[model samples]
Target chain A: MTITLEPGRPKPMPTPETKHFWDGAKDGKLLLQRCGDTGRAYFPPRPFSPYTGTRNVSVFEASGRATLHSYVIHHRPVPGFTPPYAIAVVELEEGPRMMTNIVGCPQTPEALPLDLALEVVFVPMDDAISLPLFRPAATPAAGRTGVSMGVE
Target chain B: MSYVPGSVAVVGAAETTHLGAVPNLSEIGLAADAALNAMADAGLKPGDIDGIAWVGAMRPQLLAQYLGITPRWVDGTSVGGCSFMLHVRHAAAAIAAGYCNTALICHGESGKSRIAGAQRPPEPATLNGQFEAPFGPFGPPTLFPIPVLRYMKTYGVTEEMFATVAVVQREWAGKNPRAMFRDPISVDDVLNSRMIAWPFRILMCCLVTDGGGALILTSADRAKDFPGKPAYILGSGESVETGMISQMEDFTSSRAFRVAGPEAFKMAGIAHADVDHLMIYDAFAHLPLYGLEDLGFVPRGEAGRYIMDRNTAPGGKLPMNTNGGGLSYTHTGMYGMFALQESVRQVRGIAPAQVPDVDISVCHGVGGMFGASGTIIFGRDRPS
Candidate 1:
């Protein structure tokens, strides 16, 4: 059976608070906001420090390094995704977690162990949009190529 | 403040007359049907209900209007599938505080048919839409399994141990004539089922059905007037931790579950050994494992073994998910209502898979991906 990916997958609508992060992804940079007062960094790029409710925050370029916290290799067909792909949550080096897919490795338990080192790879979806997916940092040669560039 | 144990009781409880596939009833219609059935069970009328509570698609006003009643107190606490459990807690508190005399809590979902309306598409700019949605996470099947996988790795929980949950629940399902899928399943059956997500197969997921359930609450003193045997609300607890699964305090343990379970146990002044029947909302196979450990029924990391040993099966010491649970019974998106109904049935000695001489029952629920939790303890006899 020829698997045609569903086209209705959701895309991020860039709001003022989150536009910077999306723009950063387009520029091949992983951007996270740091609270100016507490120096605590957070993910999903919020408007303020969730811990202290401080509006004093600024964006910084992330190291693009993260550890695989947890994931599931979804075999069911989802819109904009082929069957049998990994859906993962990775904890960034800066002490915050973000949801992303782990690319560049087999979507198997043996290949995607807990705390596996991963680096971000920018997959461009459109002229102004790109998504940051993760791949095992050590296996650059195994990185996925020529796949559809859309949300999972 | 700690709850006054046994101040309120569930006078009536019921699910829709026909579960699984009822294409005739819309989501709201199912809610009304269940509410009417429950009211009839309690020998009550629409005018007798002074408070109304519900979660998911149907609003309280809409449900009340459909039933031709205007409630003075209303609760629409949508904390995912466990919202109905929270409704019971809130209704008990409202009844205790004289906010309302008779409280009706209802839940209805057309999860299989999508007849109520298409599922709401997430706003792209919302927190989940921005962070989690972009990753192509496909609802609970994709998101929930991630944590269970981690839990397995951390606790040495094997695939066979996970399959035991589905197998045991199916055993309970086989006994219930109303259960959607009642065929007995083995561990090998669950293991061999088609994989939906890694470490999760078709057997691990709950059934998609269109149904609803309702419960009526009143002061314990008025319980004897109702035709149905009362399941006295001994204690209740509720808590929320996060909206996203990725942001949960820990993948293995749900903070909300930890807080909700012990609080109910403390309020009821009951020990773990006192629980005669248990209903842990089993939307997925791994949920009961978390519920068991978090509710202090077993030690952390031992629930997998506890199930594998047939401790929660039909003839086991602790009868759990006696209505076949969301797994094999009816799951209309929000499954807590059915869990509550089964607990009441077990306490009243009318459950299809009835456990003999049950006196106390605990109904524990998880909303979202461990986002919220509500736990309620029920007793056959009123507290002194």
Candidate 2:
């Protein structure tokens, strides 16, 4: 017997509130809105500061480095996705709570190590947009060539 | 918390036909039917109503138009399965405060049949719909079952414990002619029922009942003037926790009850043992178990044990869900309304299937996904 995996469909167009994030993903970057003055990160991507009560905000690219806080293994498929998947809440290094999927590994509690290091991977849904998911990054050798960058 | 001891009198209570599927009726139509019946039950005309509160899937504006009232006060709190109970508390407080002389709390839903072509309600912007909705949890059966599974794991409870609740509720329903599933059921039957979700057999979940229920509240002094029997709402309380299902603190604990139960009991000036009858929203079987434990009816995590003792069944110590609940009776979508209606009826001594010597009735409704909870303690007399 053989098993085949079905590819999921991506979102068609970005809404006015989410265009910047989707556009950044197309450029191979994970974008988040950070307060220009207070340096606080906002989610559900709002125009004004949910915190600090300041209107100064900017869309900045994220490092997508985070720790796995907690997650659940869903045995059934949701709209636009395959079943037997892991849906997790990742606590980004920047201190924002994000809901995303875990990938590139078995979807089980044993394989999903809590507080494990992760890196972002972009999975394109439609022609013009994609999503930023995270997975376990490859461990480097004794002398690694590339240094990871962190944005201020 | 010291104010004049006020009373919330249920001068009116009404419902649609106690049967299955009434699809042709719009949400507003059903609400109107219930509101009118309630007014008639109270022996008051539509013109006498000065306040309105509703709970259901329908938007507030739509229900307002259905009731044909431009009231001085209005509340449309849609708390999933347990909204109607919440409305009773709100209506009671509003009546006590003199916000309105006559207030009506109404609920209606075509659970057996939804609007054929109506668009799906839009999800809130704050929700992580993109991430959460994709995991086969768009509705109640899937979302509610998660907590039940976790509770069983934490307490080391078994499906049989939950089945005990279902069997007992079904037995009560067997006596209720209005119950959708009145046939007698056994624990073995519940265990063998089809699985709606993990650990929740179809028998464990509420039936898709199509109906509506309404209650009219008035001040204690004003209630004495009414013609029909009046059930006094002696005390009421409400509490809410994290709104998102993904953000709930712990599946094993209920934040809403921890907050609301004490406040309600305190206001009622009664202990848990004082309650005569319990009419809890039976959206799912686990809810009553959670309610029993959360409201201090029994110790925490002992809900399974308390229920397993065969207490909630017919002739047991605590006769709960006497109307059969959504599991057997008509859920009517917003089941809280039914719970409140039953509570008022039980206290007024006019209920269709009366519980014996019922002077006090505690009505509870948990809206959202354990997100919010409300309780109203009713009695036959106002505190002297």
Candidate 3:
């Protein structure tokens, strides 16, 4: 029997290694693991801290605020991406770098100003989970500019 | 312990089945084929190899088991494209410190067949896959295309200027019977090939391939007695930068190469002018262009034009990527092993398309998207 796999669909069964991350997405929060002893935030959500040699690291919700450290306007779609998207490395105010798409805004190289303030927006996927994405926050000038949607 | 050069000499190099799509060979079979050839070439038995370094793209332990050898020292440094070159540097250090007498570095891939029904290993620590892949980045082609535009924007480089490098390398591939891409490609053909990403034509990207290659490295003292001519490891260097693609300082510069190149030259005790031939990695076309600049082959932002005028192609003053390259040659996931293998051939005076009077050849391997770097400088016993 052949089972067809749908593209862009979340896995029907989440593995134990990825369960926590998927669960956090369901609750509309970006979760990061921090070592309880050192308070150092770690990614990929490991259960142990290689730094402090401590086990049982704690997982906590990251503040939804981040600053756009840098970004690239990619025009090609790999396996899962829409063409002409922005992949940005956002530095969380809480002290760790996260890679996320700069969405809900114009996707242009000019829109990627360094250190731009951004607010996290959770995008639900197939009703099973949400991906953590960021959008430029509303500002006096941002609102006054009539929300420029594209690079003119 | 920190690695000091001079203890390593590449004694043997070999490749598995080449050309056409090969589906019958398992990944392990391909690796063993290459490893055994390298061992036979080195005039050493499998039992003589105490060190084994392999790119982690394939199953490492399976390769060891298939070869019927358990190594005293093993490394699976999978930085990306430069995996094999990096292993050479690490193995050299290990050999010098009396860790092993003979070292084998190998890579194998069945990418051609894997394309239909391959499950990529779940990525654990990579932010690029989780966050960036969901959006787009088109792998290396899409990610690296914009950078060339940025390079052109800052340097006034034309598309034709970049095509010169591609065209010349294709010409070189015509001579190498093992190269998968042997047909002559012209500058116009490169310009006219359908664009994958703006500023990057389809011709500019490497072809997906399935093959394997291996190298044997031993102490310089033992190298004198090896079966073939020895390619001495004059210098080697490695470096890593911020892994995030977007966090790089600029599109035109590879900080990893910038940091690794100067130090590699320093350790080799040579300058760019002294290099008789170069085997800079060509994961993408612009990579070699930029790498040449970082290696001081030309002034910054001038590699494309320099390649055009100097004809740094196979017959040019500085022949580069003579065995095709990652771009025109087989890019079986990782291409660094091929670069080192070609360098060994060039220095040994037995390259299928040998460039005469080769005294020193420099090979540069880049992993990730300019995220990691490993450079090796090889010198023949006598300077040309």
Candidate 4:
């Protein structure tokens, strides 16, 4: 028999500073804020540039390419997740790290190596919201070489 | 800043009468119990304590009112599990500056029973709720192990090495009657225990316990007046990094640990070889590895081998977590207070698992997952 678990995973309550980033995920685009002054991009979207403390920041679509920096296979029961899923921190090609889930792959040490290439995949929690998750890149061309140089 | 060493001292230290599980004691009760016991141990009354410090469930004012202490100075520096370590540093500074003649630092948590006002869920619009919480990072067990897996991959530390940390600490626990889990455990037992997260078996994690501890600080000049032996505060340091684990400057090493440890050592003017006893807060088995390396106790990437080689076990070159630590001892949420208690016991020649001829003890603690660190060095003798 299959167990049906309640959707216990927390959903982001978008703020004015983060609404664009969440909307971008709903539109299937990985949007990151870049500082026009320092030419540095960062994650967990904010209104001002962290480096320069300047409000001169704008959102841009990223290539959605990242490398698995570190992770753990959480076996304990989380609200919406089944046991034994990968909780990962992936370093985006734009030089920011993001806390996300590694989906579409087995959650094992042998399968998930450090620096493994990953691509963004959006999962819609509801009609008005979507969350960005990552999975192993489908093609060899989807690796680091495919990272957009336009970011910073 | 010129490093001033041994200006203040810990005159009294004590933990709640019952450690493992006390269903009757609320979180504030636990703190009060420990605080009163420590004051009695130092031959002090509630009126004598002029300063108060606390973290987590109880605020300084609430604790002060509950204990009948009208403190002129207060500090509530809540930096996760290591908050008490920072408290000690602040208390010592307050005493040295003549802000208060006597300062009491207290900690209490109903971590196991959740009897106290336990942590409520983060607000939906908060930074954590908006960014990291949505990803299903389930508390410290899931969040803390992430760096360990990466550290293992980066430094070639093995699963067995992590298991050894649990096994050796259990040996120390076996000697303590107050330890929550005192039975002996082998590396195989650790490896075979139910896995909570990859690279972390259940054995590697700290026990959920309901307990509390307190410390009393005063100027070193007045230390001899205390009924109990004084543990001079030779040095202290604290630092905070990013709140999110992903933003840590380095995955393999904690920057906060590096900064805090060196600052303490510099302030104390002591070499690594002078540290006769050490307590690295072991909320998880891998923490000692990071602590050992980052605190300059061992070279980088060598702490795993150092433990595997039996350098930190009983009858080893250096004794670590001699009270079984949070892994085998009681972890009442913020564990730094307990670590401080053990260091004081060691310095006063009263620890259950006491090491011979010990003059100095080092206690290092981590707050969140590599987010903040505090290091304190205590000595048996006052600086000349």
Candidate 5:
């Protein structure tokens, strides 16, 4: 079958494996799971650890801090996004990488530098799904032009 | 059990008669046409085949019923584009272990025409639908380039170096009459073209086209009865890393490629120096770079410079993507089939832009966004 992206902003359809993640996002918390044994954190949370396959994983609130790893300045128009938005991958401080949008700044190559410090901000799509996007971290060194959209 | 090399040989291989814009053919139509052509090339009928394997827009049962083949073994292993190479690997093992005598593998995709029925979007509950689709990536043009910026920065690769891959492959394509984009193009021409994504110009991406290819394999002892010159299935390996691009292990290289390539090379019992030809699936310009580095064909971060120096161009030390690759040739979305076709052609010394004396040819492909990989090594003669 010829696959095409759906129209409009795609929302998260949380499964049993991801319900807690969405629930935590709705509550304004960036939750991550850590291996209870190894103490290593994981993202896009699952019930168990990927490294050790241990069911002993602990869910906890995160600091919402991350660093920009890589991104693409997509110039083509998709259903939900304007052309030229930054589709970014950010490395969280707790050592997990997640795909998110880089917001609160110009979506250009010059604006989004590698290793830029970032912090998570929740944009609630609906009552159930709140997408956690990242913008420049609110540090004196980084957020000169961009302001924090971090929800209290 | 360890995979022994040279037990099976691909006696027949044929691509669809019409490659680009075959609007008259549905996905199933293309696959059947290629299957029939390969059968004819092998001097056999559909009834002669006892084993069946396939992946793409259609299922094996449908193709089997359409071709009227009652098979003893059926492999529907579909991971991604490189699924065919994995099929080759499994078919060899199946044939070696006395599971099936004569095996047929097939691929067909209507990437551009979309003649096939509408495909369902990734289920919202799946890993990709919940994580990746929400990011608004329209297609591969957006998804594939996500890791390239990190690769360029980490390896100190220049824009000119990246564009050289497209340029070098175009030179090879210029010689192949079947290639879609035949005119010679320059690096600046590629850079100056329309940008699909950051660091990727239109020229750097693969052409969306319609195509299908098939192969017939059997034990080397039975291969002599076939009409086509046998390209021995020397060795093969398959592996996967992640479903989402975010968990690709490293942005600068492919973990799947690193694992699959070495396994194939080790199984083939040949050093890198022994490789006479190569076909690295180029879904995007950056793929060959990652393939080269991860496959150990070049040192770390040397692929960009290597291509820029025309090392992989026509008459270069290593003739790679000699069929113009998915970049200049037709990209049927699942480009691994075309890459396999080229490797078989070069091994048989029948490629239009044929490299001379290709004793060993390596065909490597990536499925999804660095999620899975399959490597196949083909040799001209069966190992003594």
Candidate 6:
């Protein structure tokens, strides 16, 4: 028996509201927007604070530490992903949560326990895109290299 | 204040005759079939429908043209499967206010066959595509269940507890001939049913089928005149939280469900004990858990125990998902329509697996992945 995999993963296209966040990822930094009015951090960066809709916001480096909030070990095969990989949501230490894959660790229930400590790692796809994926904090070297450059 | 409680009634309801696998039919054809069936149930014709509301791939323009009736009111609200519930709510308001004397809300999706259905996965530019999809989730099987682990951790809920939901629903399905998977399934069967997503075995997910359902609404004054007994709309409400599942306010409770459920309860002026039959959308097994608690059927963090007690099973108190729900019954992608259809049947005292002496039936639906929600309460008698 033989198996084939899909060619490439879906890449995020940078829009006006999210260019800075993607740029930060390309450089191996997790960037989030902080609302100037409330001094609160938000994810999936936008031009203004979602809480008050004030343009008083600034981009900053995130500590890249997050707890494994919840996840599903997906078994269905698709073009760009291997079966039985973990698709997860990690709650950033900064308060807001975001979606990312948990790599550098086994994708099984026994291995990926809830609240497992994770840190950020960037996978460069092309010159312009790199997806920010998460990995176990203790074993960053265990997972394969990133698949993209974070830009576009 | 213009909307009156119990001012409108669902005079007719019908699901397309050809459900499960009808390969020859297009999405629009399924909608038309359901629309006509619903109208016939009401003893009505195209000319009798003054307002039309729909949700799905089929545009309302094409539907109006195909049905050959120009409705004075139109609604094409597409939020998810629960969009049909919202349509019913909007149509009820329109009918009560004289915007339209009669309203038709229909849903038809070729979810299983994809006949003439254009695949509209989240775009690369959309929030989902940019943030969630890039992580390699092949849509709902991966996305919808993402909140379970955190929910379990926060509320002491175990996988076995939610898995019991699938078991109990299958018990209800065992009696309904139209249900897709009717065999009595045990919790072990659900746990062992081939994992599609972690915490969600295939049995715990909705069955992909081809079907459509439609409802006809008129003023409560004309309720009993229809061929089918009318189910009066006691109250209805809808609310939204977030487009991105990760951004959901809390992992355990759905903000949309919490908001929509209570609003409907308040509008209906009914308490939890007043509900005789319940239909909570079960696109995935965990939904009923959220619906039960968020709708105030049980205290928070106790829905798991509530189902485990078999309170929602056949011959149990607060009978739920009596048509087997999306899990055991037919799930045509956006299953809110089917949920609404079953609630109407139960309230009209005509369900296939009829619960005895049902007066009020509450149908609750989750639209997106915990993003949008709608609730509708129906009753056998007019509001006081």
What is candidate 6's DockQ? 0.70
Using TM-score as the measure, name the better of candidate 3 and candidate 5.
5
lDDT of model 5 at residue B68?
Answer: 96
Task: Please count the clashing residue pairs in each candidate, in the order shown.
Answer: 1, 3, 1, 0, 0, 14
Q: For every candidate structure, what is the RMSD over all alpha carbons to the true structure, in angstroms?
A: 4.5, 5.8, 6.5, 2.6, 4.3, 4.6
Q: Tens-digit lDDT track for model 1 on B1-384?
A: 656899899999989988888899898888899999999999999999999997744577888888988898899899988998899999999999989999999987888877774367568879888778877887888887778877987899988988888889888999999999999988899999999988899999999999889999999989888888999999989999988898886888999999999999998999999999999999999999999999999999999999999999988999899888999998988899999999999999999999999999999998988899999999999988
Model 5 residue A82 CA deviation (Å) reads 0.8
Question: What TM-score does each prediction get for chain A alone?
Answer: 0.84, 0.79, 0.75, 0.88, 0.86, 0.85
**Candidate 3: segments with Cα more than 4 A from true spot:** A1-152, B1-5, B57-59, B115-126, B382-384
Model no. 1, DockQ: 0.65
Model 4 TM-score, 2 decimals? 0.96
Judged by DockQ relative to the true structure, which candidate is superior, 2 or 3?
Answer: 3
TM-scores, chain B, all models: 0.98, 0.94, 0.94, 0.98, 0.98, 0.98
Better of 3 and 6 by TM-score: 6
TM-score of 5: 0.96
DockQ of all candidates, in order? Answer: 0.65, 0.13, 0.17, 0.74, 0.69, 0.70
lDDT at B240, model 2: 85
lDDT of 4 at B322: 93
- Candidate 5, residues B1-384: lDDT per residue as tens digits? 766688899999999998999999888888888999999999999999999888844488998998999999999887788999999999999999999999999887888898882356788788888888898777888888899988988889988987898899999998899999999998889999998888788998999998899999999998888778999988898999988998777899898999999999989999999999999999999999999999998999999999987889997999899999999988998889899999999999999899999999999999988889999999999999
Best by DockQ: 4
**CAPRI grade of model 3:** incorrect
Lowest lDDT 10-residue stretch of candidate 3 chain A? A143-152
